[model samples]
Target: MPKVDAETIVHSIAAETNTPEETVARIYADALDTYRADARVLDYVPLFAARKVRATLRQNSAKPH
Candidate 1:
């Protein structure tokens, strides 16, 4: 499988979640780094990172502010 591009993932998730690309990019980068820190296999890092970003966005949006 080809390596996933971070920009592409960030853009797609941002659009799909109706979030700013900057926020998504930041969260995605953090999630990617966190996952990469202890990853044994890197193939699914992007997928997992995207999921974490989405879940985080959802949680944030759900919070009372």
Candidate 2:
């Protein structure tokens, strides 16, 4: 898989979820940090991080607030 940058991941998640860019950036950073902490396979870091972030966004969107 091709390497992905934080900016690209942030923008992508933002676009896909219709979330604000700034919010996405923050979420992306947090997700990356969270995933990177115990990553055994470096190659899939970005992909995994993106998935986690997407899940969080979906959960947030489903909330009443």
Query: Which candidate has the top score in TM-score?
Result: 1
lDDT of each candidate versus the true structure = 0.95, 0.87
lDDT of 2 by residue, 1-65 (tens): 77688888888889999999899888888887888899887888888888988999999999998
Per-residue lDDT for 1-65 in model 1, tens only? 89899999999989988999999999999999999999999999999999999999999989999
Error of 1 at 40 (Å): 1.2
Which 10 successive residues of model 1 have the least lDDT summed? 53-62
Model 2, global lDDT: 0.87
How far residue 56's Cα lies from its native spot in candidate 2, in Å, is: 0.4
lDDT of 1: 0.95
Deviation in angstroms for 33 in model 1? 0.6
lDDT (0-100) at residue 63 of candidate 2? Answer: 98
